[model samples]
Target: MQAESVGIVAGMALVLKFGRGDAARCRFAISPLQETMSALLVLKDPGRHGWYLPWLRDVEPVVAGLDLGLLGLAVPSNGHGPDFLWPSPTSPLTRIEDDLAQVRATDPAVVAAELAEQARRLDRHTVPGDLYRALTGDPVAARETLVAQQRTAWRALVEPLWDRMRGLLDADITTRARQLADGGLEGLFADLHRRATWKNDELHLTGFRDGTVDLRGRGLILVPTAFGWPNLGIGPTDNTSATSPALVYPMLGTARLWEPATQSPAIVRLLGSGRASVLTETFIPSTTRSLAQRVDLAPATVSEHLAVLRAAGLVTAKRRGREVLYGQTPLSAALLNLDRF
Candidate 1:
């Protein structure tokens, strides 16, 4: 659970908007875990066991910055589950302590060797180890090795690295980062320097591959959540080195777009309402209607509408139970009331 906070740090460091920490935080912050959270929310109802990881990613920052006494009301919550619920699993602080305890017991050198092996394993695209070793080897290698190394190296190396990297930012690195973060990340690429080429369904980033990444064909790439364009193009590394245990691959892509179909029109209308669209006809912060509720519209008809809306950036659907709910696109709120006109 705590290992997931690595994402919090990484998200805060890379994505610009998750900085001030709000809905924008979910947009830029919790995106990588979108599928994971959606799948869990689908497989079981929200607040179920399978959802621990994604929910933690979603709520941690808000909670960390929140005062415990007023946590309930401080959360600007609406809807059924996620926005209002906190899981009763171990507290994040407890999980952090447990993880640290296990880390303290292991030899740092051994963990480092294991991490190197894991990196090599990724390049080979296979876990090359005996069954016994595979079963018993470090599930914690990526966590204990790289993140720990980063923390250890931070005091001595962060300043030097920051100096080199910020030559492009034009001001002191930390100051610039805080400023850029607060400015909501729009200015991040204004005076950017580097060659990032778009090619063959992927982007190639150059000029910033310092020692932050090893020579294992692994570096970070940032892609847009709204532009269908690759932004910070960095590493998409598989952090684990064990047998393929249900792996998740996250794609950094664009916002759902709008099309000119029946489904598309309906979805665009709901999304124009400025709330989340759970299904084709549902409008959050106001109304939720099933396809059947929409007169002769068939269930499949509504599902079809949802698909179009999803493509057009008009709505978003996250899995829940046997049903899928749709919500409106926040981007096109102004046009919502015009549906009546």
Candidate 2:
């Protein structure tokens, strides 16, 4: 159905309303900063962020050993946090250090106010009495605490697996870019979420929240994330009031993120080692030469494997410039659970 007004029920959905002026402003991007926040969320409550439970368990030894002291403060157990921590998704992407620097530079007064808001949210819950005592009301101290915790969290969690996560995110962007090119906002939203829709120049997130954000020509940035699965988030991509809008959504192909490099027994039995490796790598696109280099197979051998996979309707190839990029077709994606990667 076409979207006019949507209900974004809490824990169910979030509807993002757009205006005529917002059409030109809609764009897709990848955000490392948002992923960091999501990883912290996973660490804080693996049950709520259950999609990553397996991932957390797989990395438990490392995560369990790390000091998570007071870091959970920045991520409210029940609500949102200060805007400075969620930086805007910039094209060409801003480095995490640069974004953290911005957080460190936050005005002390703003930090104090945000922490107070956070305290109120926590107080409403059945939290430990001593926990509230630990939260400092001093803005300077709170900000410093947050910065130290963030650095610790990144080193402990995100840095180790960032390359794989980034590869999946970049692949998602590539797929979405094709959608945007083929169908503009409509096609992009079609695959974005089961509830997200675009019609009459309005983007609707079909849930229960009753509100509207008029882009007013400010534009919107769509970011795909691996850790924020089963839920989507909408907000300003950065700390600046004037920063462009951004929407961060759960990405596909995350299930295999933590899977070991070894081939799945079932898949290997079905497709053999050479063909199975080719299939797994095709979850994201790669040219023959690139795939050969990555899989350490001869270019001709990789091409032959691609031909067989294409004939089996498990892969598709699209030409870009002088290269032909091969990626998994939907059928193959489902069979291999590539969507979960």
Instruction: Tell me each candidate's TM-score.
Output: 0.23, 0.70
Query: After aligning candidate 1 to the native by TM-score, how far in Å is the CA of 31 from where it should be?
Result: 5.3
Cα lDDT tens digits for candidate 2, 1-341: 01112334555433445666666777777766677778877766688644576678767888767655555655754334666666666652445677678788888886777667667766536655544555655677767777777777777778666655655776788878888889888888887876676777767665524456667667888888787775666664232456666777778777767655555667878988998888888766767776776678999999999999999999998775556778888888777863346
Question: Where's the lowest-lDDT run of ten residues in candidate 2?
Answer: 1-10
Cα RMSDs, all models: 19.4, 6.9
- Residue 264 displacement (Å), model 2: 9.2
lDDT of 1 at 275: 22
Best by lDDT: 2
Q: Count the backbone clashes (under 3 Å) in each candidate.
A: 28, 19
lDDT of 1 by residue, 1-341 (tens): 10111112221221211112222311111121222223322223334333233434444454333322211211111211221011111111122233234344545454445444434433233433442243235544433342343233222222222211111111122233454477533443333323333232232233322222121222222212111122232322223321111111122211111111123455345444222223333332111233334334555655665676669776666543344445556653434444556
Query: What are the lDDT scores of the predictions, listed in order?
Result: 0.30, 0.69
Q: Which residue segments of model 2 deviate by more than 4 Å?
A: 1-21, 48-51, 124-136, 237-240, 261-341
